[model samples]
Target: MHTLKRVRLAIFLGILPSLVIYLGIAVLPIAISFYYSFLNWDGFSPAVFVGLDNFIEIVKDIVFWSAVKNNIIMMGASLIFQIPLGLLLALLLNRPLKGIKIFRTIGFFPVVISSVIVSLTWGMLYNTEYGFINGILSAVGLDAWQHNWLGDPNWAMVSLCITYIWQNCGFFMVIFLSALQGVSNEVIEAAEMDGATGLKRVLFVTLPMIRDTLWVTVIFSISNSFRVFDLIYVMTAGGPAHNTEVMTIYMYNNSFTSLRFGYGSAVSIFILAFSLIVIYVANKFTNKDN
Candidate 1:
């Protein structure tokens, strides 16, 4: 008991500083934000209590709904594009081969780069006239395909989705690669002995082993989608007339641009609640025994 007590005391001492910092930066702000959500304030003017009014307005706002739709699209795109591509590339590169380390480094390079840089780079590539993408289209005698990539309402969100995939798939690739390396060689050999090879090996032998990792990545991808602001903000600022607005951008515009602190706080609370519920649901699905 004394030894255990000593260990506990050491652990407490070790964690106390970090715990305090976490509470100060994360927990306290969230609590304050929740309290502020129930009021009317222009961020500077005196706050007035207005119970449920902000939430009610959020539910009715057409722009809020639009932002929600965009967020869903981003989540879907991440799952459909990034995760699968990551898994596929991880599979391809998991083999013992020459220059594999180089390939891995290249795969993870973009993830280390700042998101702002990625957005700005994509912004240039999407420019109407001199952008490489449009230049290639025009060169191929498809001038009709060349337009203002970020300005087109129909394609702006699509452009953002593609940029997101390019920048993030590498991170997931590294994750899935590490998880793949952890899979048991005995199980793999057993699958091969049972005539499972290629796609069959991957489907029945490999994916099942890393199911938990996949779910964790999915949850991460979904949560990241909810919080995505910088890329879209840099690329479109949630425009061509709010075509690319997402939840984070909506909250940002309300809190900063419009200076509606109370309403923005309410939006932030909604973001928190929605993310928690989604993550909870995803956790349920991640249970391997089920």
Candidate 2:
């Protein structure tokens, strides 16, 4: 009994720091936000208890709904483009080619680079007058395709989505690559012996073997889509009439810019609930598919 107690104590001590950090950074703030969501405060003055007024106002705000729509669009783009591109890149790089390490490093380079730098670089690339994309169009005699990529409402979200995909797909590539490496060589050889090669082998054997990892990437993609802020903020500031505004940016504008602490808290709470509900539905759907 004494030995068992000593082992438990040691294990508790080992995890105590992480537990405390999680509580301080995650649990405590959530609790505080929940409390603040019920009040009417502007970061100063007396906080008036407003109950559900803030939430009701949020529901009525069309701009808030627009931000929610933008977030959903971003989520869809990430799922459609980022994950598949990452998986494709991973599959391409999973072979025994010469200089493979160099290719893998290059593929993952964007993910390691700072988001601010990536945003700024992409911003320059999307510049209307002198951007690389427009320049290419002009040089190729397709000048009509060129427009204000970031400034135009129609293209802002699309541009941001493209940048988002380019910047983060490398992350999913590394993840999928690790999962691919874990797939048993014996199973692969067996599939090959059974005449399953190339696309047939990948589609049927490899993908099913890594389905769990794919599910994890899906969850990460969804979470990252909701949490996206700095990249879009630095690039467009959700600008050109808030065309690319997301829930996080909306929460920031309300909390800090507009100084509506209560309203911002309510927005944050709603974001949490919304993310959880979506993730839950996705989990159920993926399980059903399985």
Candidate 3:
């Protein structure tokens, strides 16, 4: 009993710091933001209680809706591109080839690199006149295919999506790779003996073994899509008429740029609500599928 009590006390001590930090940084700020959402205040002025005004204003703003649309686009692109690409890369790297470790490192390099640097590098690559992409098109006698990649509204969101995919696919790749590595070699050999080879083996044996990891990556991708800010902010500042604006950027603009503390808090609340609702629906769908 004494030893068990000591172990339980140690476990609680180990978790207490993290719990406190989470409450301080995440829960506390969210509570404060919820409180502020009901007020009318410019950072400096005395707050006046104006319940639901901020939310009503947000509902009426077309820009907020546009931001929501862009966010959905980002989420869709991440789901469609990042997860599949990552899984493909992981499958390719899960072999016993020579120099496989080198290849794995190369595949995961982008994930470890700074996001700001990745955004800037991609921004240069997407430049209108002298960018690598347009230059390639011009060299191939396809100048007609080239346009202002980042400057044009038609292509700005597309450009951001491409950049976003490049920056984060490596992260999911590493995750999937770990899950694939954990898959039992005995199971794979058994599948092979049963005449399952290549694609058939991967589909029937490998993928099912790592099903939980795949779901985790899906949930993470959904949450990360909502949290994307610094990359898009640096790349376009949600520019070209806010074509690439997301909820986070919208919240930042309202809270800091426009100095509407209450309005921004209201926006934050909406962001939280939207994130929770979408995640909950996704969870329900996934559970039903399972």
List, residue by residue over 157-259, the lDDT tens digit for candidate 3: 9999998898899999999999998999999899999999999998999988998898888898999999999999998998989888899999999889989
Residue clash pairs of candidate 3? none
Error of 3 at 95 (Å): 1.4
Give me the displacement of residue 268 in model 2, in angstroms. Answer: 0.4
* lDDT tens digits, residue span 1-290, model 1: 99999999999999999999999999999999999999999977889999999999999999999999999999999999999999988998999999999999998898999999999999999999789899999999999889888999999999999999998999899999999999999999998999999999999889989988998899989998898999999999999988899999999999999999999999999999988998888788787477
- Against the true structure, candidate 2 has what lDDT? 0.96
* Residue 122 C-alpha lDDT in model 3: 92
Taking all chains together, the TM-score of candidate 1 against the true structure is 0.96
Tell me the spans in candidate 2 whose CA falls farther than 4 Å from its real position: none
Q: Name the weakest run of 10 consecutive residues (lDDT summed) in model 2.
A: 281-290
lDDT, candidate 3, at 87: 98
Give Cα distance to truth, residue 94, candidate 1, Å. Answer: 0.8
For 29-52, candidate 2 gives per-residue lDDT tens digits of 999999999999997799999999
For residue 95, what is the lDDT in candidate 3? 90
Of the two candidates 1 and 2, the one with more favorable TM-score, higher being better, is 2
Q: Report the lDDT of model 2 for residue 135.
A: 98
